[model samples]
Target: MHKKVKVKPNSKQQKIEEQPDGSLTVHLKSPPVDGKANEELIKLLSDKFDVPKSYIRIKSGLSSRQKLVEIDKEG
Candidate 1:
């Protein structure tokens, strides 16, 4: 499955919110430096979807606040 995620890095708390438009808003405790936010994003998605971190891949926007992610359906 593919998901559109908007990340708010360096947040006081970590959370994931699903919007009415079907996109996701993710708050991460990690900063957006040296892939820390990306790692946190993968871990959060993995836990949320019951999949491994390896099952999620950032398809685009590696350095931007918005990102497109590809998630394996097999889990």
Candidate 2:
């Protein structure tokens, strides 16, 4: 599955909120430096979807707040 995620880095806590439009708002504790926030995002999504970390990939927006993530459930 592919998800549109809006990432808020350097948050006090980590959390994920599902939007009505089938997107996600993710608050991450890690700062957006050296791909830390992206790593955190993949970890969070992995737990939420009951998948391994390797099953998640950031399809786009590597250097932006808005990202497109792909979750390979069959993996």
Candidate 3:
């Protein structure tokens, strides 16, 4: 599955919120440095979808707030 997500790094709490527009808002306690936020995002998504962290890939926006996430269906 592919999801459109808006990420907020350096947040006090880590959370995922489904937006009315069908996108997702992700808050991560990790800072947007050294790929820490991305790693945290993958971990969170993996937990939420019951998949392995390696099964989640950031398809786009690697350095931006808005990101496209791809989850391996076979996982």
Best by TM-score: 2
lDDT of 2 at 3: 97
RMSD of each: 0.8, 0.4, 0.8
Worst 10 residues of 2 by lDDT: 34-43
Model 3 scores worst on lDDT over the 10 consecutive residues at 66-75
- Give one digit per residue, the lDDT tens place, for model 3 in 1-75: 899999999999999999998899999999999999999999999999899898999999999999999999696
Q: Against the true structure, what is each candidate's TM-score? A: 0.96, 0.98, 0.95
lDDT tens per residue, model 2, 1-75: 899999999999999999999999999999999999999999999999999999999999999999999999998
The local distance difference test score of each candidate is 0.95, 0.96, 0.95
The best-first sequence of candidates by lDDT reads 2, 1, 3
What's model 1's lDDT at 26? 100
Q: In candidate 1, how many Å is residue 7 off?
A: 0.3
- Model 1 lDDT tens row, 1-75: 899999999999999999998889999999999999999999999999998888899999999999999999685
Candidate 3 local accuracy as lDDT? 0.95
Model 1 Cα shift for residue 41 (angstroms): 0.3
What lDDT score goes with residue 61 in model 2? 100
Off by over 4 Å in 3: none
The TM-score, computed over Cα atoms with residue i paired to residue i, of candidate 1 is: 0.96
Return the TM-score for candidate 3, rounded to 2 decimals.
0.95
